[model samples]
Target: MSNRSHEVEYEQMLLSRHGLWQHKGGRGKDGPMERSAYILLSRIRVQGPMSIGELSDAFGLDASTLNRQTAAAMRSGLVERIPDPAGGMARKFQITDMGARMLDEKRDYFVQALDKVMADWSDDDIAHFASYLRRFNSDIERIEGRPWPRPGTDGP
Candidate 1:
């Protein structure tokens, strides 16, 4: 198939996946936590505490939108605002212990769901697919100049 055809197919797949995430309770239980919360928590977990402005730049979201999302997270006790370790005027948000636990649980559930869906695939096939997906995401992040921190690494 041509590159254009592949791009179209990938776009459709992403749209379908997004729809599933939105309509299905992908986060588990009654889905009390919003997807944005999960994403923000995950980012903080990996990158350590970050200011509203930093998160805004990282996610390409407006400060007002992030303010609302972070406010909700704080209300739920998933995150807390603390003085920036770097001694900045604006405080940074850090994931709480509870947030870390919840994020871990949600991650495990997501992995299990993927396993069920890919049950027919061999281990090698799954590994290759995962590698490709990672590469694809990395390329997009690089192009957008917003690469996420590598897992287990402190972000810049």
Candidate 2:
């Protein structure tokens, strides 16, 4: 079968540019959290607390980058550093109550926006689209060997 690599690449770029992650509908004075902050907090929420080393491995990011991100998060009171629950040497970053609240608000806003956008789509079509996107993301995660933790599943 022929590959539609170019088509997929262009469409993916467009989607990224127009995606919910970039939406500007935050409900508070501070506006939405930065993309990095959102993703980091989301990961922590899904997978529990994470140390710097674990975050680095999970995201394939460097220590310096994670340090900056986590530091910013701490300053904003979105996360806190605590002794590892497992009694490990490195401290873990845990999302704060405020962080969870903000994340939930942002997520709810995004869902509302998506609902409006997909108002005309059938339930079956939405399910199919979600399935395809999950498959695509799973394939990417498999290739990278860095599976993400899903809410209802063991992993990925």
Candidate 3:
């Protein structure tokens, strides 16, 4: 949890300081399109409705940059501006139902990719790995003031 340990982990995983950017999941994408899309969708899916400012903070980006990206998402009907769950003047941006469906599709794609990559492993191996991974992630979340990503979560 210290700066030194965090940097080491980032160096090992090729992750940025925020843990959103990683090299492992960057394969087979047109530029960073797939990565950007996946990360954006992941935040929206995990955090639920959020303001443009909140998204900017979560992704460590500028407002104008998200404005452009979210404009495209809005045009595609994948993202929508909605009443802020927090109830503020700023509108909360949320993934539409269509967006959620697309997220599910991408989730399946990632799951399939993971399955193929881990195909040699036995069922017990898969289950064991999954359990430990969950525990590791839960500990990280406890440190970060965030909840583990999953359905029915209160936050991302």
Q: Which model scores highest in lDDT?
A: 2
Global local distance difference test of model 3: 0.71
lDDT of 1 by residue, 1-156 (tens): 999979979986885775445534456553367789999998888899999999999999999999999999998889999998988899999998878877887777677768888999999999998898888889889999999987866573
Clashing pairs in 1: none
Better of 2 and 3 by lDDT: 2
Lowest-sum lDDT 10-residue window in model 2: 23-32
Candidate 2 lDDT, 38-67, residue by residue in tens: 899999999998999999999989999999
TM-score list, all predictions: 0.84, 0.92, 0.64
How far residue 37's Cα lies from its native spot in candidate 2, in Å, is: 0.5
Residue 48 CA displacement from its true place in model 2, Å: 0.3
Candidate 3, 108: how far from true, in Å? 0.7
Clashes of 3: 0
Q: List the global CA lDDT of all models.
A: 0.84, 0.87, 0.71
Query: What is the Cα root-mean-square deviation between model 3 and the actual structure?
Result: 5.6
